[model samples]
Target: MINSHQALSDTVISNGYCVGCGACAVPEQSPFKILMDSYGQYRAHMDDSPVFGRTDSSYEELCPFSSSAPNEDDIAKQYYAETCEHHPQAGYYKGVYVGHVAEDEFRTRGSSGGMGTWVLHELLDKKRVDYVIHVRSETADKDLNNIPFKYQVSRTLDEVRLGGKSRYYPIELSQVLKTVRDQPGRYAVVGVPCFIKSVRLLQAQDPILAERIKYCVGLVCGHLKSAHYAESLAWQMGIPPSELEAIDFRIKDPSQPANRYSTYAKGPSGEKVVPTNNLFGADWGAGTFKYKACDFCDDVFAETADVVLGDAWLPEYVQDSDGTNVVITRNSDIQLLIENARNDGRLALDDLSIEKAVQSQDAGLRHRKISIGYRLHCEKEANAWVPTKRTKPSRTLNPRHEMKRQRLRTELRDLSHKSFLVAKKTGDLSVYTTAMTPVYNRYLIQKRSFLRRTYFLVKKTLKAMIGR
Candidate 1:
């Protein structure tokens, strides 16, 4: 009767703030449906004549972007206030470590040190949870065009093992979450920051899900990319988007640094593998094809998750081609599991100070936490509706140049999505490149000391001429 989507449609959806995590669509009677938009990014579509708030969690309360919804800080504090130490950027934490699974092929098979999959498998092997919900490659079609990967329910160790590797493409949670609701069992979900926060909010609303969902696992995200990111990489490899079948985003090459990875793509003609660095939009810092919501998010570490994992992008660990993981544990139960495995010689872990853990994702934290204000400031200056965020909007919050950097990133993100769509329509990959190259180059220049040097040189010349 309340027409739940009225508020969401007006703000989050209208402003392009929706992240398509699918928590709103999980309710059986919900009006929201998750669908891939023309930009190849999934978005929430709300149906007419739908009621808001099934229980205490109303539409605003449930949607992570809503002003009324509990933010990562609020959610993390609710679950982990007394048990964990809090940081401005990393939320709550019980323990932090850098390590890799020593016993199995997890290190080699995973995009990182294998702890992402290893953590899920540990729970499954111990019967701690009946099922695991994580994204997995659907290898049914080696050349998988329709949907190459999805959020699947894995019950056994083998199934869990099948679900490793980082997927950069867009994925939503509604379908898999619905599966968890239909099937009665203890379930653990793995997602990025906002998705896990969505789960925590949903749990507070629905008793069934709250009881069955035993763990909330998180992946430390720089940001979520649209499907076009995968398509762009494939296109660069001569596999047109139309002919794209399957893609492996993280192919570890031992000769290179752990952070340097390759991408493998297969099409009807043949298969191709290329270093990820060779691709134009491969720069994570550029935020190419990234969801707009990511620009405003402050949570770099998945604060709402019980346990979170990410690549140890530190100097000491980056040399190893085998890869390493930076793990943060908020729950003692998960901490014990890792310690037990290390004690059993199945895992090799080292104590990582909070400072060092934050260092691993230094750039991401600065962007999300510090640069967020510029993004918010930009939106407000245009008189647009933005979700209430933990950090308030202010251009002066960061150093002056950072605002310039944030604006350039904003330009790149918007242009990539729009240009890629044109490319998809015209069947010419250059449409995207033509549109993005200069801006990308400009962004790269902003990252270097070249601009600062040029600025100072020009300033000195102008001062001398004026003095004369």
Candidate 2:
């Protein structure tokens, strides 16, 4: 809440909770830049350049954290059911959930097999979309040398490939929406669950957006982390943030026997690669600078997006891991594209049941469910669920994983108590304090356990080899 900064070219805010997910800080000449303030939290600073389009409050509306519209559950559900019934596609939705891995080079390079970008490329290549309104990164000039990358979109896959997974800090989708409105063409977009939801909500409110956007791709997100996540990672790798050249949060080891995962950064001297498990525990999933809006979000399955994609971090996936993406396609059109791709040998996939899909998500959470289902309840009633706080946990943890669930439940409860104490002491009881408590707590506990297990397994395997 830095009042000194006012909205001019684009409405920007100092959401101390920003995780530098690069949703805002895209390279594509946005009116705003994601920068770290004195408090160490990342906030969007309006780029004073003349090229930033006419200043408007519209960007504020696209923000997932502070928006004017009620979270429309009925529409989300109706869309979900309708997509499944009449136009079901393979690897689309898991039950009512919508998400899938994209079939392209991006799948191997992205955070989770590059599915989000895959969808964008397909939409463009198949002529189903004239433009793909997804974010891409650009290098900063010496004037903004402190910043490494910025985000913008391009119609061609070549331009989109330039941005790759280098996150642009503080991106605003309203700018892209405005672009779509002006250009007047069908486009596909990739965004976090809430950002995609915002598009659906915006389309409902603004007829122009409704007519413009053709498809939505969602990333399976637990929470969005802050710039500190990047800072800390760079520090750990001995690459000062300013010296960093190229970075990718999730990098599939193309040369590894099994795309053994790594988080990579390129500095002036060379590259640094750290096991993906090492990065998962501390910040990306749950830590300081966690986006406040994500706590209240219950769309882990991305019910709003036409497709969702994430890493299939299960025991079976380790065999060939150059990158095995777990995709859930919610839109039939996108599904048809996938089926066609696989048939034509562009991609390969195995049939996954809905039960398996849920398991993939819960394995990371140790099989417990969070109760943000006011949306689901509202959908059943065919009404809008005003985005607000509710205390109940709706989704049940997988019953078969009861032992694991209990361990996670105990850890989460302890974390919740600690977070509550912090919130009460600060007296800043933002909705995230209540809404995200379960998700944040459960994620931390489960991820920690997963890492520990992976570590021991690696250690034991090495020991056995030595003994032999």
Q: Which candidate leads in TM-score?
A: 1
* lDDT score, candidate 2, position 45: 71
- The TM-scores of all predictions, comma-separated, are 0.93, 0.64
lDDT of each residue in 1-468, candidate 1, tens digit only:
444557777788889999998988887677789999999889999776535544323777888888878788878888899999998878899989998999889988888999999999999898899999988876622432234688889888888888888899889899988888889999989999989988998899889989999999999999999999999999999999888888888888878998788999988899898999999999998989999999888888999999999989999999998999999999988999999999999999999999899999999998888778778888999999988999899867445677778889999999999999999999998999999999988888888854686689899999999999
Q: What local distance difference test score does each model get? A: 0.88, 0.54
Whole-model lDDT for model 1 versus the true structure?
Answer: 0.88
Each model's RMSD to truth, in Å? 4.8, 10.7
* Minimal lDDT window, size 10, model 1: 139-148
Off by over 4 Å in 1: 1-3, 49-57, 140-147, 450-468
Best by lDDT: 1
Quantify how close model 2 is to the true structure by its C-alpha RMSD in Å.
10.7
